[model samples]
Target: MAVYTELKPEAFARVSEAYGLGPVQEVVTIPEGSINTNHRIRTPEGRLFLRHTTVRSAEDLRFEAALLTHLTESHFPSPTLLLTKQGRPFLELEGGRVSLFKWLAGEELRRPQLTPDHLERLGLELGKMHRITQSFGGSRDNPYSAGQVRSWLAGLRRHKDDEVATVAEELEEHLERAEGQRGQGLEPRGVIHADLFMDNVKWLADRVGAFFDFEMACKDSYGLDVAITLNAWCFDNGAYLPELCRTFIRGYQDARPLAAVERENLFGHALFGAVRYSASRIRDFHLSPLPPEQLTRKDFRTYLARARALDALGPAGFLALLGL
Candidate 1:
């Protein structure tokens, strides 16, 4: 819904020619995400996905493009990056950087349609991605890590806004507890799609066909990645689905075995994952200076709700469901 930069037909046509995607027939803005501008462009050749954003540095853009390319080459089901005529992965347009991807075919599965089998397949894909990216040469530090969340909190405190101040104080306490628990155990590190929510994946024939949106990809604990998936995929109607959790962990372990430490502290990481996204949702949705129309604010309270649900199911209780 946020189209920061409007792309005229001529402008889009030029990009199409530059990328050898044939003459553009139509341009349609995708109104799903809040972060960047996305468009589905139709050309005589086929459909192409053009994403533009001024928020990312050229370095970050290059990093993302290269990561997607790597994923494709590694037999991962990700979008195919279209190269420019000069063979570049992206183009530096006047307004923002534009990257082209082949349109992936499939529909995103909604929560009501999700089953334990679906959760297991999602876990299986995540495990395969973790295994491939373990040796990936590229790395980006997580911008939404606990340290960054604290920094965002500090910025909010300086604002003198009461609501902002309240959120910061609450997040401060949660961040402190989450960070303390994070140091209790160390897990194997890899390039993780730090934000692997259901919406970011597409399903074909009731199975995962592609995993997209690597903008948050970074070098992090594989365990934390698993924990993030657990928080995102296992909860339903303010409750944790224990059978789904067990199926997910089993599927993840089917590809990459979890260490003893990962099993022992998995629930702690899930709590921190909850903290991470909740803090981010607050900062991005409420505190940031984005316009109300442009802002696609998510309910940060749901993540807090998820954290409470997880707390009810202690580490032993969570792992017991995982049959660990």
Candidate 2:
């Protein structure tokens, strides 16, 4: 239902021919993502995921293609971009760019279905990805940095809705406090999968089969990545699950031991993560013009709750909560 760009039959045929995929047997619209238009296309060869996005530029796509190639060479479990007949990573069609990837084999585990083992495996995989990306030569700044989030919040604070405006003011305070307490920024830096929500991971039984959706991948603090991931995975029903948090961090540390600096600065990073997502949800989801069928709206208040909880815990209390 998140198909922002609708492709015609001729478009599909052209894409299949260009990619050397045989006649298309089936085309089903994928309704999961919020940014790009995705479809599951079945050809005589096999099933592939077709992603079309109007918002991304050619340079961005190239960066992603290069990153995916590096990941493939490193033997990381991720989607490999299929090249066109001309050796390009994607094709231009229907006023947007389209990229094809062989469908990965696995199902995304829902929140309730996730266990400590699942979080541990996910953490290990994330840690492995961060380690692998250290050798990657590509560089791209995080598009959703603190400054960008602050700009979004500034606009939200002037909204016509009093509740939204008030919430924006509250988030501004969190952002300011987090920036002040984040320290001298001496933590390790590297490329990270900025958005590692549960849906980004696919599982084959208890083990992770793949980590996809590298569109938001960019260079940033590794500790920030850990904080964002913890926010995504460890929180449920307005609270952070202590057991899941402990297991996730333990699994990550097993792969690449966090420096003492990382441990000390995690609280600020976590608070920033909560503030960033809360602002984004309000701007991208709550205020989106797209109808319900075209976009999935996530509650901004959920992340606001996370910010409040983090603030209540304070820095020392947070480290204690994570048993760091």
Candidate 3:
């Protein structure tokens, strides 16, 4: 329902012709995301997932295209971007840029339905992705680093709402502590899916179908990706699920073993992940100007609770919780 810019009939016709997809038969809006507009469109040829984004620059899109191409070459289970008749990865339209992907098959599982088996499979896939991308020559810096999140918190602190400002002030403290403790430049670096939440993955029966949503992929510490994914998958009912965390990390290490440095630095990375998402949910969902139906408002407080839990655990307690 986050269709900020709706496509017209003429626009669909143009896309169909440009991609040689034949006449468009059905167009269904995808109601999940917050930033970009997505649709499941069917033409005479087949069904395709169409994505339109005004926020991403051409350079960003090309980086994603290259990353996807590399993943495809590696035989990774990911969505394949279909080329236009001109062999371009994407098309420029009036309202925004559009990219069509051959619809990937699978279902996105909700939190309650996810099992330790699913986390294990997901972790293995993530590890494989990181391992595969180590040879990828393309590079982009992490956009949601500590410094960037601190800047976001600074802006949020000035908001008129007292609750938002208070939370932002608290988050700044957490960010400071996490950055101070983390050995910043010592971990193994690679291209990471910086936002690998559960919603970004798909499930086919008991196995992983695909890992989608590469918009936030960037070059960063490999440990950071593990921490971010751990935060996304292992937390439930206001607490971290220890068994799930253990299974996930074990699966990840099964593919590419974590270095001593990576293991030692996971605590700081996890804390930073909590702070980053909490602040982002505040900025993107809690304070969004979009109407209720257009965007789903995920409570920032859930991530705030995570930040608090991590702070209470400290580094040693966190490691113990993960059985690291």
Candidate 4:
């Protein structure tokens, strides 16, 4: 289930009343992402996707709404909030930002194949989306920046959690070194989806459907952007798909080829991505008071292996493997 809990009509009615959205007859809770609770709200005559957050301060729901709206305005496939009788695109209430969207129409992408043609299309689509998003210039550099990574590494090196913290400390040290070597060589900053798991990219036959879940969207390095996509698309739980990487990189290049520095540091950004998700999982589940499943099941083992590969992925390694 994507939602942490079910929301009842009475509860929703309270929200509806505040926003003047009228009566809500039923509220069917949908899946809860790592950060948000989403429900499919069914009124007497229509259905809309309602995203509910636990605490007012836990999320930037308004930012999400604005981002979604901006993407929609650019003709990206993101769903826009429905208009109320008063023609408002969304309604803010005591429950947080309660906007309704016409449900995303295509089937979720499952086990997406990296066929040459398919990857080409995917890369081109992402390029167009990124171009459009860059036009907005609304967001800033993500707080989860390289500097934050460096600081966190220093903390881990202090070895606060015995064995777990020790291992983290070692890896963190390595990542810190990698970060130093990278030192802004990871260039071409722009808008990126950041979390474009194939699961988030919808499929409509041979064509691309829509990109969903703009919650993690931000401005970051174009190389880092490609790294995140590679993390999501090319690697799975246990192994890396070298062919898939080639296909995806080719596709991405078809849109905008990686620069010399960007291509060189792609592995570091991707390995960093692995550590990023693993840390989040550990912090969200083991370190926090939240329930077990509050953490996503999407495993980070794939990234860990990629991290292992990072040692061997010098410029020569990339050239030998991908002709980059």
Per-residue alpha-carbon lDDT of model 3 for 1-324, expressed as tens digits? 676787898998999999999999999999877688898999987889999998888888899999999999999998899889999988999767999998989999998898889888888999999999999999998888888999999999999999999999999998887886678557889899899898888889999999999989999999999999999999988899988999999889889998888888898898899999999999888998999888877989988988899999998999898878
TM-score of each: 0.92, 0.98, 0.98, 0.82
The local distance difference test score of model 4 is 0.64
- Tell me the tens digit of each residue's lDDT in model 1 across 139-231: 788777777877877876666778767766776676676666665656788889988898899899878899998888888888888999889
Predicted structure with the largest lDDT when compared to the true one: 2
Candidate 1 off by > 4 Å:
157-161, 288-295
Tens digits of per-residue lDDT for model 4 on 1-324? Answer: 545545655668865665555678777666446656777776654676777655433335455666777888888877666655666555555455556676676776556545656656777777777667666756655756766766665665564677547656656755764675454544777767788877677778767788877666677876776777776776655556677777777777777767787766766677677667655544443454555454344443445566666555654574445546
RMSD of each: 2.0, 1.1, 1.1, 3.4
Ranking by lDDT: 2, 3, 1, 4
Clashes of 1: 1
Per-candidate Cα lDDT values, in order, are 0.81, 0.91, 0.90, 0.64
* Alpha-carbon deviation at 21 in model 1, angstroms: 2.1
**Which scores higher on TM-score, 1 or 4?**
1
Of 1 and 4, the candidate ahead on lDDT is 1
Clashing residue pairs in all predictions, respectively, total 1, 0, 1, 4
TM-score of model 3 (CA atoms): 0.98
Task: At residue 13, give the lDDT of candidate 4.
Answer: 80
